[model samples]
Target: MSALSSSVQAVTALWNRMPFVGRVASQLTVVNIFDCATRLAAQAFLSAIPVLFVIGAFAPQAVRDQLVESLRTVMGLGGATLDQVQGVLTADSGNVKDASGAVGVLVTLASATACSRALQRVCERSWHMRSAGLKVVMWRWVAWLVVLLVALIAQGALHDAFGAGALLGIPVSLVASVMLWWWTQHLLLGGRVRWLPLLPGALITGIAVVALTWGSRLYVPRTLERSVDQFGPLGAVFTLLSWLIVFFACITVGIALGYVVAHEQPFDRWLRTSAATGRTDPADDADLAEESAQRP
Candidate 1:
């Protein structure tokens, strides 16, 4: 009875020291799902301006007309019914002029900036660390660029080789998705080391992300469809809100999992140590202090 009592006390103490552990663990299970949804939303928002710029800057009239026609077909709109859209696309001056276009470009740049800042905030919140500044941000961008280039090239090659009918595409897509998650985590966490150190934890987290994303894709959309069918367009708003909740939940989980995978000590142990010491590790403390000092 005494031994059992002692074990119970020990377990209680551990939980007391790391109250967030169970919550974080449960949350981590859904991390990728939330991350995918939030990231998709953020990307959609940020990419809109740039996409417009690209259309205006590079696409020819024929190409633009073809794109409009494609969209019309997809949306089941009447033929050439997007006349206003074409006019907007072809508008030469006034509000639609290039100078006015700069506003969207600036907004896009701001969104990108916000994403980097938000990523840094996530790192700080999760690991008690901050990235160095423009240098770190630039490096992170370069890393992502490399990852994106590789994914695009590989995806094209694989799709061409396998044709549209092959099952190999799924696995290839999964692998690419994992690589992307890994790269993003690596960048956000200031893990600019050799690939060896970065790959293992990144791979683990990436796989988790891929599984969650695939599952969400399979399930959430259908669920949302049902809700919309039952509740009308208002249901779409609820669906979006649900997506946001899931997205943040996934991010918290992924951050915790990444920290666990990368560190030597378990979170419970670290939490206990921090509580007992009444302070974080000196390195973490210094990093936080530095970040505070650097903030504008």
Candidate 2:
């Protein structure tokens, strides 16, 4: 028993001595990142899907076409699989078909804020910050949702900008993704965290998005077709939900990683150094040193 106890202590001591690994392990202990991702994905499926249905049913034809094309380009959808997704989105359920006026659309968009709330929790947990009150962030939720839809709708053009090879498109997409996620973190966090600290996570998310975009373009279409062929429409649902889970997982992990990267060792010093040197914005001063002292 003594020998076993000693061995365990020694191992724990070794792990504790390794700074980088310890920080990562600490972050993981602090946040169940994969679980957060799963919840975000599921929430998006439940909340965002209805909004998509509403948009498909009522949005202008040009907007609808752009949305569909964006989906096609991003997910590499075509043929039966694409048709299945379209059918689901455009389904004439009496409530949705009967839905008219801005009231219904606004309600659907409001429901979609559940996703925003989920994402907000993700950012809060990742950064080890207290939650922002709904009153403070209520409009942010809707605004973020609107921005998200616009970004998605514009995805096809972004991807095809360099003649579909995405040679130049990839870099452009990376920058756009970084900017979007950076703003998203700031917006969702109610600007509690400095932009510089947020940049690492945004960059991580941007790279993840670019990689996943290419991965989906390469892997999703054929796999989706096969799944649909084998299990009917339900297969598409499973496949997409699976994809969403992975996508959200990457995002959650990226945020957590960004936190780890930003706060750990030399990077944290750099942020402090930047602040001291006046390179960062004056607004960053108040919160700049806050995260450094809170490292796990």
- Which candidate number would show the highest TM-score if scored against the true structure? 2
The TM-scores, one per candidate, come to 0.55, 0.84
Task: Tell me how candidate 1 scores on lDDT.
Answer: 0.51
**Residue 249 Cα positional deviation in candidate 2, in Å, after optimal superposition:** 0.5
Model 2 regions more than 4 Å off: 1-10, 87-98, 162-165, 273-296
Q: For every model in order, what is the number of clashing pairs?
A: 3, 0
Candidate 2 residue-wise lDDT, 244-296, digit = tens: 99899888888878887886678878765244221344354335334432422
Clashing pairs in 1: 31-250, 34-246, 34-247
| Positional deviation of residue 164's Cα in model 1 after best superposition, in angstroms | 5.4
In angstroms, give how far residue 14 of model 2 lies from its true place: 4.2
Global lDDT of each candidate: 0.51, 0.78
lDDT of 1 by residue, 1-296 (tens): 99999999999899888855864554343233355346544653454345444454445666565555433322222322245446655655344446546676555555545545555455444454544567667656545544543443344333223466335655665576566665675576565332333343456555554455445545665665676688976665566556545544454456556554444356435434233222246456555645544553
State which candidate has the highest lDDT: 2
lDDT of candidate 2 vs native? 0.78
